[model samples]
Target: MRSSRSWRLVVEAFPLLILCIGCGPASTASPTAKPATTASTAAAVASVEPDVPVAQPEPIAEPVDSPSAVIEPVAPQPVFRPDDPREPQDDAQLAELGIRVYESRRLKLYTDIDSDAARTLPGYVDQLYDALEAYFGPLPPDRNGTDFQMTGYLLKDERLFREAGLIPLDLPPINHGRHRANEFWMREQLYDYYRRHLLFHEVTHCFMTFVPDTQTPVWYLEGMAEHFGTHRIQADGRLSFGVMPTSPDEAAGWGRVTLIREAFADGHPRTLADVFALQPADFLMNDAYGWSWSACHFLATHPRYRERFEQLGRDGRGPRFIRRLTELFEPDGRDLATEWALYVVNLQYGYDCGRAAIDFQRGSTLTAETPARTVMIEPTRGWQSTQVLLEQGQEYTITATGEITLADEPKPWVSGPRGISIRYAEGHPLGQLLACLRAEEATAAETMLRILPIGEGRTFAAPITGTLYLRINDSWSELADNRGEFSVTITRAD
Candidate 1:
């Protein structure tokens, strides 16, 4: 079952910035107040203003920059034959035209567009934002809301894309970055999605200002946008998205799948307090997007999301969101985990009581069986510091002992197996460590694992919510020195 993970509650190391280009927005231009589902590109442009920091990927490999984290470009250079499908349009000279469109529509959006395809931005904004606000709710008046704008650096040359680690589109994947006044690269096709999702997502950042500090869970914010990504223009012209996701389509990107996978993997509820404690760094953009999106989706898309959102809105944040939902299922209403279990069941199965816009998935419990074996670890060699890989939605414990070791004194040796590791502070990064923990290992567990803790197992919860993709450090501690042979177990955490 898809646990109810709240975006506001999760520790968002950094915001994700992705624009799939095809689907992910709500727009209605050509006329009228134009359903929130639609807006005049000119109106949307006028409505958009300012900017903010925001949002992923590799095959789960490769390095990515978060709001503050940056990695050098990957190898196996990428080449786009001047005429790739994502080539920028030739409309650079029309920034003023875009300005004119913004002026005409009264929309609050970016005024400086640098693409060769300029004048059309107004129309795009109108239709794009109109559609977006319709599905997610109106953009907030300021940063408190989700309204946002950015200086789009349309990439026409391969050098531009390469600079952002966007080349080798085949080598895992890398997403660009954005902040209030900083720069972000975008493919021509990306504009299509950005003008829709990323743009609105930034706008959502604005809406967040209105969110009561107490009610702002990391899960709701991202999940709502991600959940809305599946929206489509219905025959009646109304926006709609009701039906369990089926493969990949234009309306939703592969991002949808990633969200579900994370929610199922991250299988429980996390507190906003814990999330707030994380370093304010953009480490895992993909995880942020997937995790936040799932967190929100698990709440709003659920049968009880509306009630919870309403209660929290009425009460103005605090414990209402959690308390209200807990009351909905249990008598005492304390088992937040059970509430999450309920959410997983609802999402995994989805609901269609006949309203509109209801989309969820099957809970992981339905698919996952109990682990045959479970135990804690101090993993070593071809492994990482924290490699907690249990079936999604299952529980397990981590145990370790002082354990025995074979000492080989002050002799310089590099053959056989020498457990290598790097230690980092609280604000340190797993991505950075993963890049360094390589000595003839591949599988994540093998490439970077830690072992021989000074004492017992590092007791912790399985990462069963948000983006489950994580890497541990190549660190370890012996009774005294650094060279020794040790063994630990990774069985079920029963």
Candidate 2:
């Protein structure tokens, strides 16, 4: 059964960003079925203001003066031509349009685009291949030792795209790309900014077919594709990601993020537990795709959950998705929904994953000095925790006091106590140490437990004479101005 991960606590002064975009399904279309809605190019472009960093892919080997500076083009190479006669008679009309066939070791391209666009096709496909391979592992070969080669049909315009008959004409123009089996089809953009973005997104669907049919949930199937689909190609062709927006001007994914934020504010945010229960066919809402992508982004790139997320994929079973979630998130008695709510509300482009993991330690020991010691919790300190020794039947008091100053919002006091008292496991020191060393590194769920709330602070007597691990947390106020300090002082009760 899906756990009711509730979110009733109100966070005062949670000022969120204002942006807008309509939600849609993935761009991939099944020829006979309704087109899967993808993030619309029009919607993506509309959401980005002149100041926001436009989401785009870096050209392979192009040098940059600055991140915002336009990428210089590489010297033109010849367009692709097939080594042998091209089969697939459906593309006959494209051949008449002076189409060129570019064949690389791993991909085959069919497009009417000129040499400039055609030359870059190989590099783009190669970049997507490397990125997808890194995350999902290498692709399996067919009966023939030759690697499975994916074919891309890049139509010159919507008219040509429609005439090609790859996607049904009934689908809306917003559907820019579609992946059918091992083939990918996409229409060319006039002023292409997210051209590579759309290309990678569709191709990712083709690559996903290799995963064992473990009845993979629709959210994961589409979410992971969109997650990698948003990957930024580096100058040297290596993939670079996990870049959270440092400034307002640098924000990307305004459309998807805006959609999710609005939903969350409306109290209809898609929860992980909810996503797990859904099948792919049923997850047809546009926000579902967007939330799925964000969820995948949170899990795949976030330092704390990366490994476990990969395991979930490798395990490739639907049940494992929920099982891992229960084990990793709810174990600490911290509701996943509450944590996710805070994450999406403040989410912007270029989120920093590594920094977040360090700031929010999952299973680490905190050093606490005796009697009256004050431990500071800062915005940069995500969820660092510590352990204090207490005698059975002895009472200890904990209080948190601080105020966070945002850019344009009121300075709210770092609300209520954010600490959890963990009962010490009874075991031999050597045995425990060995087990700790040998055991899978503990995740947040395995180590942390429910906070014993007593007033705005916790004043409780120890039930056993042992060390009590106190986890210091916040309301997930990850705003840039989340830069404040809360001091925790622990003392024995009279």
Candidate 3:
């Protein structure tokens, strides 16, 4: 059994999304193969045509002198004060400050100070709900209408926001927003971008109450809220999702993504297993919010992994769920760390999982009698795989040479075009990311053309005798020249 607790994402001034408490690899190339050449054989692809610039949500700075913006490493102090008396309800006094309550089919907005930004509160809430419903479906049945209808107090400025005493005075100022029970609070001035982001994030906290006895992991809970918090409304009134920017240079969370990726590069990356194993207390102790959100984004948008993630939602806590996780996500419960590292490093904003999906094919068969066999081939377009027959207990080495011309413009997944990889026949978490990368299961190519400095040269002993798949992939492909050109030589040792 797990304990219940609340979750939140706190930055200097950003509104933290808090949740109530309750609970809770690998190699390079093959052996016997020649050492991989790390030298650059090809120049990087020219820049691609720029895409229509998507506006990042404007950042709001909190007023100084307020200590609420500072967060310590200790356990999160309860910012939610439901037992505190409600704000004074004097119609005349409130009218003086332009306070008003707007009602909609699914929301009740309370604005402390009425203004153009305040008026649009309902519309934004509607957009958030529309996007959330489209992705997760209608709110869980157990949630009452009041649960969704938040009592939002839009303070006029940081001074007023701090004075309200909605949150602990010692905590950092939550510039974006804050939520307690069904009540939401934020400072509405300058613009609504930060305010909207806060509202969406806190509202998601409101929806969490509906989940049945299951004590959902804080990573998933906050990740899902961050997934929706960055929602963008289109001109047609449709809600677009998973729009977190690609680089920290692009937006706030985007920078966090880069930090996580860099941390991985530094050999300290947090794996999916680490995040999944977190209890309520552990989540607040570390700065995993950005990584958690990225994981959720990967699961939600990646068509290959989306359904599986949905299935995971139905699972409850305890050993049974752990068994399910091991059965579906981590077959051996070991390679998960290595496989997840490969997946997150290659992730990019608007990543198209369909393009880089794994495709196994019976490539030109190689006969391993004595002399080594070699062949020159190009990776198949997309992820439709090419394969080769291997025998159990036999050791093999694979070497790749040459590079493909990637597009000269910004593309999804990783930048430019991707290179190639080799893997054992297992499950595809998302089309491109492998479920398992056991030495016996699968391995990457020694070399491939790509931006990131992933390892080269794949060497491993065949765990089973059968047809293993070699996949041609990149972050994604768009232009005609997105394919990589390479030569692979396969050798068998006695």
Candidate 4:
């Protein structure tokens, strides 16, 4: 997410409302098309300008009787240059053809939608620029020290843009959005938030073009776009970029979380390596986007890996980008894989990385002098280490005692080790005590941790030699609302 005051400058500039309509030559065509355009466009625009009547085109002036009386030739409007510097267009001409143009410090948006939907969008893009700069460092300025700016076509009618020569003939047909150099094109989306999301996603691609000679992997490229494109706009009009959506209501039509949960539930969860190996063709389906986003979000936000992950932005250019990234995590690769598995298993909206982080301390084996170990397992945390390593084929007895407050909203709902019966997570009772073995050599996400129910007491032979980790089973997204802890004791059994 962006800093607290990231939108201060934008808010000051566009207080109350920010839709700045451009002044241009009035349309010379019939007003019938404008009504149809509004009716067929996204609902956001219609809500903004519900009943505004379209203006009739200006009438052509009759030829003057005295042609030579005083006919000063009108100077043509200056060509607007996008960041690419390859093709420029006359801004006034585009506006005259029913396209409304919006400009900011970093973007020039041309669209045929009503002005209401365009409100505060330019400022929002400017805010996005600030966020991109915050994450990837400031982009290098041109020779004159001017910041880069891009051109975007947010199209409501593809035919209109094609007829106006705005869309290149050679440009490939896009279902949603595409970007090249400093220009991007996207069709109007069904929802307003999704429309902005696709816009930011493409704009992120344009921003990354500054990295010279970058042969960055396809996963990183698209993942980074997805990472930066997820955003939230507060009810007060404050804008925040790169945020995880807390609920479905807040981010309508953005279903990355749902896709991930469904994929994992179907037993096809993509491991970190699986995500890394994804090819460009894999992105033709939406599932690839979900997996890529999960991997990037995990590495970028997790405390242990975030520092090294952020270095990818600074040192991740050139053909050796993937090689360098692999080398960076190779040391902790096993632990990372285990943690990633845990993350995916519990993935949900508003996932808290700090609470889910596992403290990996190698455990000492049970001995004659040291027989048992007790660990405090917190309800607000994902997993806690017991510092006791069990041997393969050896039996161990586990006992936990304590009460915990699962929630305090309507009233404090307390539960013992047995947990509540009304709700369940991962097919287990909510707030039930759960156990898992984390072997040092286990690197595959699918088999790294096998959770077993251990409510109150249980005696079982070790499935494999590994450290013992325990937790109060609960929804990953709802961990923050929980309170209290459990006292769990482990001892070797005869």
Candidate 5:
């Protein structure tokens, strides 16, 4: 009877296991013919626009640093605490930083990530919780209204992290092929960082909680943080700020930025303020973080945009308000989607950051076995083709240029934008991801977007390009954010 049951199980699952494999005369995974073009032809209706500018004051730098400013943030005094080769940190001192943020921000710093998993680290955890209460007021982990939990996570190292469980960005040596653990940062590092920079980029996510927390594009969610997250304290009260794309995580945004900069890089650069008025929503075919960074950069630096951001910061996060905000400015750029598509094509042709002669093969799907140092194109606009046909073996990359939308559809299971569905490989683990993307002593109901679905869909162009990606996986079935859709373009850079 036991032998018979074993045979039956194998028979029940084989064919469904792998839809396709290895490229050949015609690998099972090969996309069915619809049309294969290096890039989809741009419809004239979505006219591309010119680059705008960030309107910052002539001496804006002086004011922020001055003592009389409203924020009056004290900068950190500089010191050189060289990294100890002997005490080599297995990973970036990220976990330590996580621990600190927990304590300082929430005042529940006792619960340490490295501490025993069975119970919470009271001191670390308490501080983290306390800080949350103070900043935007109370927020129970379970519910805040938004379907998704705008949260973050930390992990120790590659091996232990993968062993613990995570969705690998890619296979073999791909940066994303395997799972990279994102967990909590220890306490000291978190405060030290905040004191110097007078920044805790994480708090920006809190901004979402306060407002409708509407479907914020990836740019606003991460780009704003990247812009402000870099400040560090000098013991003497001077602040040192790192470029927004400081780390591998943040550096990834640059791939997209380079293209836009190049577009207006020559002759006269566009004003940052006018660029902000372009409204990312209007541009659906570019990398999200890059676009958002540029968008935020305009607000942070452009003289006019500086005033705009200051004004908006005073207002709530709502479509009506944002729409009203746009009315106050002039169009600096246009046709964001086309500009984005062209940028990816350029890199795919030859923008070696230090890898292959041409590492990225542009198309809906990528063919490299290596990991992407940067996400070349993260789509934000939703599908607007009026038709989308996807297959398991077929992969695609979406640059998050704006808020993308998706058609209504049921998926195998995944988190993020609604109407998204995709299947992940068998080895992928969903439980660990849920645990990792959280505050150290996170309550049971934290709405962190930890669930990785094989695929997700939304009208937003960036979020719903296709299921083929380097990292992230399923267990994300219910968390799909498929509320709206956006116009999208598919590419075949090869």
Candidate 6:
């Protein structure tokens, strides 16, 4: 989520020339006033002025050559510093207002929820700090070299926080979460997993503020935050960030995977460029978050782009960050788009990034000297190239011989070329062979691989001239348990 107010540093020397948008007047109303509903409160908060003093016009000086030179007194310049320390709230007064304070190494959390999760949020935030440090490098200490720390409010009841004077009147109202500088605020979430998820997401924003000069694109800012926020706590209480959740049970209330799948099914799938072009306003909807996360996740995890993607973290804080990013992947731009399309279309819980990484290879046209070509198809991987280009309107014959283990759970289930019917995926029997023709220069929008089930043997006419790519019909999430390979041959039928 984007911050409600954009943080800016006002130069005292040029106060009259600088104009700060979205700056409001400080509130004089009593905090004890009856609290408004969430929506109404957000509207009120958005209009309230921040505590910063308003800029005043400078006085003009009389000409030095005049007989009686006079200079008017200059108005005091309004200075704005985002890092200025907030007024300390008395713990005793906070306790009286039913606000519980929890502190750890990096986080000082205040919440009204009496649940154990709320009590443990500070520690969880500390773990999230470590994770961020690991990913983005350690944040520099303050000018005085003091260790960095953050303050957050997890609001179970907004009224309690408001009454305690913890919720700033100038804070922009948010639907779920918001962050500024080293502080953040979040409303109570229904699920513990999602609660932590949001906490981590807001903390990511806080961390990014420490990085200087970053005009990072909205897609990346939100996407990387969503990437890190999508995490799993291990049995040992260790927090793991950027995890591919194996099931909905592990990531309850997180619908990123579901959102992507639904979009693809609805024929509204976003391409890599589409995701990159997302504006801050687009993020008000949930679908923007899903697409953003997918793009970041794919680039960050894919073997082909991981190194370059990581480099982006270090150098992605400038105005030219997006242009640099585009240039960095310019060489593989086509492949990037094609692969991204495949990734979203096959996205699911427990997606196997390594196994599903496609290796695009150009194919040669068949000739009289070589009428047929054979290739080995692995069930453990996705869409292996057959290296045989097909011409439009030409008929081809395909045959396969294979026996593979689809699973080993209850009992090892073995299947031949014509996959077992007991289990199915993509409306076809699991372990069955599937084929699709992809044009040499197909784009994400044009790269939807239509499934052609060619179990043991089949003869079919090519709908379009393109390279043949094959894979075993199975769940994109369940490829790990697959074993063995199929020896397949493709021949140009005369």
Quick one: best TM-score, which candidate?
Answer: 6
Error of 4 at 287 (Å): 1.8
Give stretches of model 4 more than 4 Å off: 1-83, 443-448
What's each prediction's TM-score? Answer: 0.36, 0.57, 0.58, 0.80, 0.29, 0.82
lDDT of all predictions, in order shown? Answer: 0.33, 0.49, 0.45, 0.71, 0.29, 0.73
lDDT of 1 by residue, 382-444 (tens): 122233343434444333333322233454322111222232312332111111121121221
- Quote the lDDT for 209 in model 2: 54
On lDDT, who's better, 4 or 6? 6
Candidate 2 per-residue C-alpha lDDT over 251-326 given as tens digits, one digit per residue, 9 for 90 to 100: 2222455556567657776655555444443333466666777878887876667787787677544345455544
Flag regions of model 6 displaced more than 4 Å: 1-84, 443-448
Q: Write the per-residue lDDT of candidate 3 for residues 1-494, one digit (tens) a residue.
A: 01111111111112122344211000112322221222121211111111212112234444456658664345423222122223544544545545566666556665666555666667667766676655554543321223345566666654543443434453333434455555555555333343565567667755553333234556777677767766666788765655755333223222344445556557666656466554444433223555667677766665555676666655533224444443454432223333345456655543454454443344444564543554433433433232556666777766555555444455432221123233211222111221111133333421111211211345667665545444434333232345444455557665
lDDT value for model 2:
0.49
Worst 10 residues of 2 by lDDT: 430-439
Clashes of 5: 162
Q: In model 1, where is the ten-residue run with the lowest total lDDT?
A: 430-439
Q: After superposition, how far is residue 75 of candidate 1 from its true place, in Å?
A: 64
User: How large an RMSD does model 3 have?
Assistant: 17.2
Note the residue pairs that clash in candidate 6: 24-49, 25-49, 214-317
Candidate that beats the other on lDDT, 1 or 6, i.e. the better one: 6
In model 4, what lDDT does residue 204 have?
A: 82
Candidate 4's residue-wise lDDT over 1-494, tens digit each?
11224223211221121111110111112322111111111221101111111112234455567958765565543222223454777889988888888988888899998888875677888888888878877665554556688889989988879988988775656456766667778877666777787788878877776544434666677778888778888788767876777765556566777667777777888767678777554555666667777888888888888889888777766545655565577667667767887788778778888789888887779977878888889999888888889888999999989999998878888988988998898789988999988774653333436788999999999988888888898887788989888889999976
